[model samples]
Every structure is written in C-alpha cells, then in structure tokens.
Target: MRGTLLFDGRCGFCTRSRDLLARVDRHHRVETVPYQHPGTPDRYGLTEQQLARAVWWIDEAGTPRASAAEAANYALSAALGTTLPLRFYRLPGIRWLQEALYRWVSNNRQRLPGTTPWCEREPGTCG
Candidate 1:
C-alpha cells in the first residue's frame, strides 16, 4: 500500500527523523511532505500548528490518520514489511489503550525526539 507522510520540515529533529525513515524505507511505499507545503493544510484539513504537533499519514485509498506515537508504529511496521501490528491496532481493547497511550505521548512529544518549543505551549494545546 502507498502512503504519504506529512511532517514538520523546519525542525531539525523532524528533518533528521524523516531522513532516517527515508534511509530505512527501501520500497518507497511511504512518501514524505512538509506539513507547511503549499495546500498541505487544505489537503489534510489541518492547521499548520496542528500539522507541526504530530505526524499525519494518508493511505492511498484516502484514509487519513494522525498521531505521533502511532505514526512511529506505522512506519516501523511498514519498513519491516509486516502488517501484524496493524492488525493488532484494529482490536477493540488494544485499540483503545493504543490510542490513549498515543495521545499521552502526542501531548508530551516535546520531551521526545524531534520536538520543538512550539510543542510545549500548553499541556494539551498545540502552539
């Protein structure tokens, strides 16, 4: 399946992570684009600030998903050429916890890799 990755290009950390992913992703199933690219916000139905806050993924079929932690898992599974985890993401109980955990990380991702000062504006609010 083909997918597009929307990311923050201005942030050094974000650029490095995307570069790493590009290096590991040999099949090129995933394509990266800066969230601030022209028409990106309109295309993704997100504000520039929101795009900066997390990663966005759009499947070839047009389904869009966004969240930092989940994006990590998605990229890992895709690079590894496995769909087992993706399948797991569909389970009810696990799905809830996964989303909750992802939300927690997304809310605090400034403390993780590739984060910027803009990510720490408020506990749950993006700058």
Candidate 2:
C-alpha cells in the first residue's frame, strides 16, 4: 500500500467520499480503510477519538502524516499523481483556510447532502 486512509466507516458521507476516491484511484495507490475495521486504530497508532475527529492518512511505514482536509489532500494527490495544490501549503493563510473549511464541513456533515436521516441520529448510530 502506498498509504493508508483511515476514515469513519459508518458515516455515509465518509463512505461515499471513500468511494469517490477509489473511482479516481486508477493506479490504486491509496489503501482506504475504515477505522471501524478491527485493530485498525492500533495498527495505525491512532486513537478512536482521533479517528472520530477526522480522516487520517499514514505513509506506508505507518507514520502519521496528516488529518482532516490535509489527509484527504494527501490521498487525492497520490491518487491523481499530483500533490495537492501543494504550493498552497506554503502560502500564508491558505493552509489555515483549508483546515478551517474541513472543520466546518466535518462539524456539519450530517446536514450535508448524501447523509440519510439515520446518519443524523445519535453518535454511534450515525456510523
């Protein structure tokens, strides 16, 4: 696996997002795995709480790389064979904006399209 993408398997939106990534992963570089998979958190050295907060991408050796939007960026970049508007990471304020946007979307994911009524239910219920 070029990298492992740990996501919320139970979240409809997250699952859908993973599907989209797979569709574009012609070279199959990303290993998108749901954190709910047994022993996944331990394998990646991530806590359930951290996995709950956002998507995570770890390079092959299982080194923590990025989370949330940054993590997604890493996976997509690898998928398409081009780094995320990587220069943006160096631009003043751009990185902050990207992370902020991810937080907003994550915090309100239940309200986003593709999320079913059941997905809006109590915590674990959404999964």
Candidate 3:
C-alpha cells in the first residue's frame, strides 16, 4: 500500500526524521513530502498550521491519519510488514502514553536535534 508522510520541510529535526525513516523503511511504501510542496496540503486536506504542529500520514485511500504516534507506527509497520508495533500502538494505556510523548516532542521540536533558528522563527516557511 502506498502512503505519504507530510512534514515541515524547513525543520531540520523534521527533515532528519524523514531521512531516518527513509533509511529504515525497507518496504519503501512511504513517501515523505514537505507540506509546502505545490498542492500537497490541499490534496491531503491539511493546513499550514496543522503541518507545522505535527507530522501526518495519508494512506493510499487518501484517508488522513493525524496523530503523530499513530502515523509513525503505521509507517513503520508498512516498512516492516509486521503488525507487532501496530498492535502495541492499539494497546490500552500505551497508546495514550505514546500520544503524550509525541505531542511533547512535536511541541518542543525546535529544541530537538537538527533544529535551526529558522525553525523557531518561521516554522511553516522553511523550505
């Protein structure tokens, strides 16, 4: 199944994360695109502010998955062709914890690795 991972292209941290995903994605089913790409956001029904806040996963059916942790799990599962992580993501309590962690990281992404001053100054316009 084909899918797209939408992210802020200008964010150093986000770009690096994309790179890591590319490297680990053995199935190559996921395509990473900057939200600023022409018509990308509109095609996926996403907004600049939403893309700036978190990563998104759009499936082959064009269904959007907006939760950061869920997106990651789905992408990784597609790459590995295994449902273990997906099962874990669906587990009670664990999903909530992962969501909280994802939110914390997304909220403070500028302070994370690969971030630059531009990430803090003009979030959605980097690329």
Q: Mind giving the per-residue lDDT tens digits that candidate 3 earns over 1-127?
A: 5688887777778877877888878778888777777787688887778877788888888878754888888877776677787899999999999999999988887789974433354555534
Model 3 residue 11 CA deviation in Å: 1.0
lDDT of 1 by residue, 37-79 (tens): 6788887777777776788777776566745656655765676
Candidate 1 Cα misplacement greater than 4 A, ranges: 84-127
Model 1 Cα shift for residue 10 (angstroms): 0.6
Please identify model 3 stretches exceeding 4 Å from their true place. 115-127
- lDDT value for model 2: 0.79
Q: Where in model 2 is the C-alpha error above 4 Å?
A: 115-127
Residue pairs clashing in model 3 are none
Write down the lDDT that model 3 would get: 0.77
- The C-alpha TM-scores of every prediction are 0.65, 0.84, 0.84
lDDT of each: 0.68, 0.79, 0.77
Per lDDT, the best of the predicted structures is 2
